[model samples]
Target: MRRLLRTTWANTVLLALVLSFVTTTAVFAKNLDVSLTELFPSDRQVKTTLVINKVLERFHYRRFQLTREFAAQTLDNYFEDLDINRLFFLERDVTRFISNAGQLHDQLQQGKVDIAFDIFRIYRMRVDSRIEYALALLDQPFNFSRDETYQFDRSKSAWPVNEQQLNDIWRKRVKNDFLTLRLAGKNDDEILKQLRKRYEGIMRRIHQFTVDDVYQTFVNAYIRTLEPHTAYMSPSTSENFDISMRLSLEGIGAVLGADNEYTVIQRTIPGGPARQSGQVRTGDSIVGVAQGLDGDMEDVVGWRLQDVVDKIRGPKGSVVRLQILPKAEGTASRRLREVTLVRKEIALEDQAAKSSIITIPTDAGAAQRIGVIEIPAFYRDFRAESEGNPDFRSTTRDVRQLVTQLKKQQVSGLVIDLRGNGGGSLTEATSLTGLFIRQGPVVQVKDAFGKIEVESDPDPDIIYDGPLAVIVDRNSASASEIFVGAIQDYGRGLIIGEPTFGKGTVQTLVDLNRYVPGDNTDLGRLRLTMAEFFRISGGSTQLKGVEPDIHFDLGIAGSDQGERSLENALPWSKISTASYTQHHSINNVQHLKARSAQRTAQESGFQMLMSRSRILSEIEAEDTVSLQEQIRRRESDQREQVLKEERHRFLRAQGIEPVDEDAESPDEEALEKQQKVIDKIQTRESAHILTDFIQMQWNTAYEQRTAK
Candidate 1:
């Protein structure tokens, strides 16, 4: 609803019936093989199909089933779900839209070029029509004009609970969006007005795109049939994913969702106001907001979701309040809990590079250090690189510096952490792997055809020839897979962690502006999944992420952690082996694994995690939920309490004061315990295994080097 892709707001007036199916009179026969009445029983149905077809055709798509009956139902659903009845626009505007929508449907089915022009012309009319109205209210205080009071809950009260009242409810909604942007530092002065005018001018041309949206949507629908992830990126929405993954947006700490009024907290950023407060939940919905508590809470009904987000966002340290509506059942209304939050800068540290030290004891009671470097993503600021700056930020550059620092700490073994890294810059991923292995093809990319392009580490010298291991998780995707796979293919190091994040497709951002010439310069960008990355073994890293040699459970409470959890991801299948040669020795790795398996069986921490996983799975698999089931739930709570008590008893045995079990307030003691536990487990792993696996391998490699 809040079309943030910067397209002009058209208020979608003209798609009432699709004329693709004509009256059986045989007046039209240009690939029009069906009866309009059969496709659409009513004029409204016909218009909806027409709109659907126009948008579908743009993707140069093939195959679709839009029956007139389905079109009506779809429209009904869309309107109900979006609460279109609560629109703040004038009745005349809505009526015109309904009329135009029908005409457009006819033109679309007829395959008329005029249909394209109609899209532009009509969208221009709608945007131009509203510009003055929006301008009139731009400087005004937030006003709902309390025109009506209608209980909008249809299930509770059937029929129109005062249609005009519903309209008034939505009318107040759009104003809030304008205010949100202004609060986020956009002044409603003359300068911003000019900027908006320019941006909107460019946006309108993009919106009038008669062919592109339909084509892309069609492609997406088709792909959705196969799987969700394998689809065409509409040229207008390109680079959007890249922007999101990098954590570089300005404004509020919240992430945007499709629906205008609802939001899902992706990850609460650390050091931000939300994190500092620790009250705003990850899945909380921002039902309403106020500049402050005393400010009136406007009903954000029928508002574009992103517009609501814009309203809540502000400069760092600025106070804002969100009326949180958490997820709930239809029978139960989500509580409108008010939370006062402050705006602050947030960064994705979890996605950044990290390092760890695994202490392994040798036979002589001496401690050897194995430093682990975790590269979550291949990050680089190309904008910085192009400016002739040596300080151009990059993962490879950062890891190389980290290597120098790690060596200075006298570490004998190194673990490159690729677990949970979704990958970034192709260049950085390739170059980073070269730091470990002496150059070769890191990954082979194949396009639409069988043709493959092998991307190699364009370098031949190994950065660290010491005993090495690469720690990977199910989330190690794309370039992360390439790096880990290459290392394993050449037998350069040990691979640990679960299977990686199986995103192996290569996407190129296509700007719509390139196709549509002048006046549409700001047309959205598209990211087409153009190619798949293959390892030297000819097997594609599709649904399967890289598997670790020494696999360890992810220790997540109940969630799936790696390769198979993602939806619509490409399938994991292997092609015939490519002509390649193995280059390193894991002869000692098999031996270490035999020892590690035996040792891990005795570790209380490992056993605790495994047992906890079983209990967690049982909890997740339960489906019973009713008021009567509350007693059963209390029993389950008692079971959890028992587990907590046992854990506390164990902590007590270790001379650690177990955290309190009040469970209602913030768990400060629990957090402290968790940190300490993670520290104890990861730090003592080398000695716990009773074998200096990395060190033994390193010494073997060193002796091999010396023998040569």
Candidate 2:
């Protein structure tokens, strides 16, 4: 399962998932009596829901008690799930729902789910009213010169006080939508037509929502209230999850979710076409998708997320074109760009660890060749292993070979780049950690009942023990944290870059369909958080993650991007440190750090990266945009030009010539290769860091011999 960011909007957007399609565009009438009985969870579903709820209440690592407090939290979460932007439900509606919050626990215990349906009914009515008002607003011409701003992020704002207030909100929403299309180069008539279709699609999708859909959404809201990682996946979603885990699908390798009308990228799978293309990014909106190079673009803005995904997935070796609306830079508007990628099966080779040599400059007019191993994930072919394949693919096996090859090349130092490695098999993490160290405990696991299990290195032999560094970023998580933490604990290497993603809990998927007697229908699955990971140093890598010895602030850290940013995340704690020998200690890390700081201060590449971060932060913080088309276009173009200049300047400073301005744009293959080159700049810097480390080691050894 994809780990969702802590942003409420991101989670709520995912709830707008696969609703069964309906042909009719039913405009809901005010007096329509939508039956709550039909909208509630089925007997089997309710049975499964209750079973999982009980399990979480008792066996979850947090062991949260089922009390009125939890009940109220669940109630708040349900409202947020239904109407995160505070656009649909009124303050009165929320107040009325509060009276039912304290009774939710009792209701769930008895398997009475009328409350969810009742609240959903009110939400549906509100959506209908807003859609009607928004459509009516389009009838009047928008005043772009009014100098008004729309609060796009209203998740924290209070609900409108009255109908007129709500209408005013819709008025701005409609205007913003109009302005967005206009900025996208759409004319007045085309903008109106598209907006009308978008509103119609929203109504159609909501009307098509099944009882199972509503129940799944509400159950997930309840589950999330318990903990962010724990989740209930409906049967259909369970199948998709299995497919994702199997890595069998031939597609762009992106996890797509609905964000209002747009199908947004949730996460890009490692070794997938989307990730390889380097164009698709998290939060980018897929406005249009096309087949082949010359196929007509299919507008996907108002389509079902699953439908859009289907269009993107195809036979291996096929090309899919995506018209992307990048996440607005800060508060500025986004421009659309087209990216083409060839769909392919995400083979083991794609994610396997690879090695390269980077030459680090030295003071004596010499250079040290450092080996850089880029590990995208801690992956393993579980099926092959289960089938008794002796040569089963795994991260440790791949890296071991890469280290051997690098050693053959006579590289002076080593750096393992784990940035954006979200992690995979825990077994691989332990085994990989074993590669760089002698035998010892790699990580510890703590159960809900306080039983601690030590997972130790299976191999006593060290593969590569040269001067080493591990480069990580905010997306490095779970098993990545485990490996990096073990390295730190053992004094085996220096860690560089920002703190990791801090996801240390272990989750187990329970198939609910298995427990239902004689039920062949789709009974969902439950992902329950069962255990927490503790580093050998006694500290839990839960919320704190693994802090680097040398930190590089690429400006991506400290956002709502890690476990600590999550709501109700488990707190950091420590136990008795595992008894282990420190194979190698970095006594000169402070001196090395000082040298790195000096270089970073004067290095053009580092300074350029800092500038990029500042621009990104500014773009992210801007929640409002100017409605005037010319001003919006001018600001966007100016930002784009500035970014282009920064890129060229950085390249020139690195002694690499910038591409000719009038030259034809690179093809898909060239673009993918260029992405690899761009990614290696950091690796080059890491090699430099490792070079400093190696120099410090030699100096320390020489001084010790002289003193002796």
Candidate 3:
């Protein structure tokens, strides 16, 4: 399953004081017919709030206090969560809310969430008004000749000072919407009809928001002030989370997150239907979903994220079709591409470790073969293992088999590719690290009470002692950081690629019902941060992450991405280093780094990768888009041309023919070929670097023998 972070279930019992809370409140019932305009905090929500505040304050790793200052921060986060673009609420509205921040701290202690509801009420009004205004604008024709620009990203912008200022912003936004459709070859009538439906759909969904939604949003805003990873899941959301963890749902295996009104694809799970389709990409928005091959496509624009997901999920072996708005086309583009997929159960075997070989030509007649193992996640079947299934699946067990097979192939070196791995089981991480080392500590865990526990390798065998390299990227996090950090600390392998995601903290899912025993009201769950991870070398991977010995310039700056970019993230710290023997395998790191740098500089493939990275970086840096039709079209074309030329170069370098830039999505075979070309560019270079190290070791041994 695709997850935001590594999580464990908390086994500790709730405090006696928390368990003593009176559960006399009427159980909140879900009623679709309830008026959203008069939303109020339920008695159950009040009780849940008190428990949440107590739990967070007493048990969270940060030990956060509900101070007046924190209350103000929560209010700010709540406002941003509701109106991120600064397009709805006025300056006076924000000021009015800010003035009451001082009193919010005390009110919250009494479980009075009236202020949250009050602000949301006004927010709903603003949303309704804005959508109404936008709908009206669709009837009017926009002048494409005007050289205007729309500031699409206004998260940091000041709120509109007055109604007139707000209207101007909305006017530009509506015009840009129209222009985007026009450029996509839609006629004026089509554009108008789509825009009207889209606007009305937005209003309709907002009106459908229930009391639970309001409470979840408000509580999470407060939770974020404590840490980014800690979150509150509503009862419904909790059920969905459970379904995901169990991997029981049959659907497109893609994680979805809301980006404003659009349901954006966060990632595709390995071995899932979405990944097998090869057409769905991260950042793409699902604008429409249909059941079966012949079902009518339902327009899902502006729908609730869960509702959209419900529309897409179905029984095993059933076919589902998705109308995707490609991320490369930007948000304004109306062009949609459809993909059909057969949903299937995402089994453990689907995500099993896979192995391959990369051959590098040496100066001598013989070529050097380097084995590459790609681990999508650190996974294990705990139930199967507990049941004494001798062949239970696990990352370490799978990799051990792969290593044995690779050795049979007589590969000179090995590479572990963990570029997009977001981590999994903690035990798997420790065991996986043990596969490369004899016996030593792998990682250190510090609990909320400052108790440090050293997680050591249980096995004493070194499975693969050959020249090794671990490739990581920004998405490599949690357990991934633990494994790579240990390898780097013990000098067992070379750490390559970008820095890992600096998520050193560990979270545990807490069942709220466990605290309030008498209440059968289904209070949902809390994912709370409870511990921090440190490398055996004493340095924490909290915010700094694990920096590679040989860095790959992938456009993203380390400081601007990963845990460092998150709000309220724990700072990097150090503990007493554990005693472990270093292999001294990477003694010639400087020489290896220089050689890799020199080779990559001259390599055409690396040059093209860097060029593509630069263009993407430039695009991400722009916060505004040109509203003028001619200028916008020219810019879009230029970007496409540059990217297309780079793709052609890459294809040629791989000895493959380049396809047309405007061509439809490629078939599964073509996608596999393209993926291979991408994999070679990164993995092949790492293989070459490892081969250099192997050759250097041979030369050093020869010189020493001669001297002796």
Q: Pick the candidate with the highest lDDT.
A: 3
Kindly list the per-residue Cα lDDT of model 3 for residues 158-258, writing each as its tens digit: 99999899999999999987887687677999878878877887777777778988999999999999899888988976765554444444567777777
Model 1: per-residue lDDT, tens digit, 214-307?
A: 3444334333433333344443334333333343343344443433334444334333455444445444555566775477554443334433
Ranking by lDDT: 3, 2, 1
Predicted model with the maximum TM-score: 3
lDDT, candidate 3, equals 0.80
lDDT against the true structure, per candidate, is: 0.50, 0.75, 0.80
Better of 2 and 3 by lDDT: 3
Which candidate would rank higher by TM-score, 1 or 3? 3
The lowest-lDDT stretch of 10 consecutive residues in candidate 1 is 13-22
In angstroms, the error of model 3 at 160 is: 0.8
Clashing residue pairs in candidate 2, if any? 329-619, 330-619, 330-620, 331-622
| Candidate 3 residue runs with Cα over 4 Å from true position | 1-37, 240-247, 294-304, 329-335, 659-665
